[model samples]
Target: MHVPDGFINAPVSVAAGAVAAGAVAVSLRGARRELGGTSHAEGGGERTAPLAGLVAAFIFAVQMLNFPVAAGTSGHLLGGALAAILVGPYTGVLCVSVVLLMQGILFADGGLTALGVNITVMGVVTVVVAYGLFRGLVKVLPRKRRSVTVASFAAALISVPAAACVFTAIYAIGGTTDVPVSKVLTAMVGVHVLIGIGEAVITMLTVGAVVAVRPDLVYGARGLTAPLKLRVGGELVDAEPAPVPVAARSPRAVWATGLVTALVLAGFVSFYASASPDGLEKVAADKGIDKNVEEHAAKDSPLADYGVKDISDARISGGLAGVIGVGVMVVAGTGIFWSLRRRGTTDATPTRVPESV
Candidate 1:
């Protein structure tokens, strides 16, 4: 749900800008820790550099295919769940940033000046809230692999409502029009609840697939123990293999899988996606706030609204757009993640106190 320009007033947007800025500041330190103390600076710098751009592009493309739920309302994958699952949380924030920047500049989706608001509402808050809850659930629940998927689903489901509530609170503080806060809250939450279900499933599936393939690579699965049955009657027993070296595994393979998944979702599957306005659009139209929407700067772009201009073949045009979007997002997301990963190292050594102290 991109909060376009003019939905929230200037003062509130600025306030959100402040909040977003503070969050990014906090995430920098958080990302450092998440990446581990700066000791073994080998693989992260390169792998994480491209992930930044990839994150942005991924979020952008995924947000396009709004799945329908109710009359006049639809929902799409927010990527908060997906990003936090695939990449670390701090990098997740950066991923959303790249998507917001590209959307505002190229897609004319969210407003340029209001980019900060979109980032705060969609990027920072979602990652912080989702990742925090995801870790907590993982801690409390049974340490089964399925638990990870279950936790991912729940985290994604709750995050959307939380985001809706946050938007309502933001609008209450800086809404441009005199719409009733309750109506906005109800509608936004109501529609987004449906969207959150979609998010949960998508997040779980994506996370599950990755975990199954590269359990060691997933940051969330770090501490969980694998089964170790003792030898019986001198017969050999099968066991889960040792964790893969993050460096040994090919980034290109991971990127290819993720990019293929994104392309399929956006390119072909999106054709059958819901054709209704999303939560924000429905609420705005219902609440009369849509009138205040300013023109998107990129409206004149040929690729505006997820279609190539004058392309008669719906499948080809839409497919090309999806492919391009996937390419952009993968490259962009990879760049962002790679950059953060570069600044970081994989070592997890604890700092020791000085003997004198």
Candidate 2:
């Protein structure tokens, strides 16, 4: 849900921009520790960079496939928890940032002037809420492979509503039009609650699959203890073996997988996506908050609203956007991750070694 320029008043949008800036600042510092301190340098540098990009592109494509939830309303995966769990929280924020950027600049999905608001609502808030809940649940629940999946589900479910609350609050403050704040809050929270369930299911399945195949790579699942402890002599220890470093995929494999997933989701699957208004649209309409909704600055652009100018076929126009978005995200994410990964490698390398013993 990208908030266009006019929905939120100028004052509120500027305030949101400041908050977003601070959060991004914090995330950059936090990411160094998460990536450098935790992940294996060789593998992380080589693999994580490309993988992060793929994750962003993946989130973008998946978001296009909005599902029908209720009459006049639809829900799409916001993908904060999904990205955070797969990669890391800092990187997840960046992933969502990249998606918003592409949407605002190229596809006119969101407003350029309101890009900060969209990133703050969809990226920063979602990751913070999702990661916080996931960590808390993991601590209390029995640690198992399913625990990660379960935690992911719970986190994603909660995160969507949390984002809705945030948006509602923002509207309460800087809403350009007069509307009842209580009604907006109630509607925003209510519809988002249903959307949360769908988010949870998708997150659970995705996390479960990754944990099954490459548990070690899951940033959230790191250091997870097995549910059952084994008795060894007198004391007990985790039944699971220590995770080994998984090898990076061949370059061809990474390239092929990311591209293919982006293509399928954007091109074909998008056709089946629900036509109903998304969470933001529904809330805006019902709450009368969209009375001042401004047309996007890039409204006249060729790629406006994820369509090409000359393309008569809706499928083809959207398909091209999906592809281009994927390409852009992959390149951008790869660049950022690659730099972080390289820094990690540089830090890990020994400056000097003994020549003789």
Model number with the top lDDT = 2
Residue 52 accuracy (lDDT) in model 2: 75
What TM-score does prediction 2 earn?
0.88
Model 2 CA lDDT for position 11: 77
Model 2 lDDT at residue 179: 84
Local distance difference test, candidate 1: 0.74
lDDT per residue for candidate 2 within 274-314, as digits (tens), equals: 98999888888877788887888778778787777788998
What TM-score do all the candidates reach, one by one?
0.84, 0.88
What is residue 194's positional error in candidate 2, in angstroms?
1.0
Flag regions of model 2 displaced more than 4 Å: 37-45, 226-259, 347-357
- For residue 282, give model 2's deviation from the true position in Å: 1.3
Distance (Å) between predicted and true CA of 323, model 2? 1.5
**Local distance difference test, per candidate?**
0.74, 0.80
Off by over 4 Å in 1: 32-57, 226-251, 310-312, 345-357
Q: Give a tens-digit lDDT track for model 1, residues 275-305.
A: 8888888889988987788888788877777
Give me the displacement of residue 267 in model 1, in angstroms. 2.8
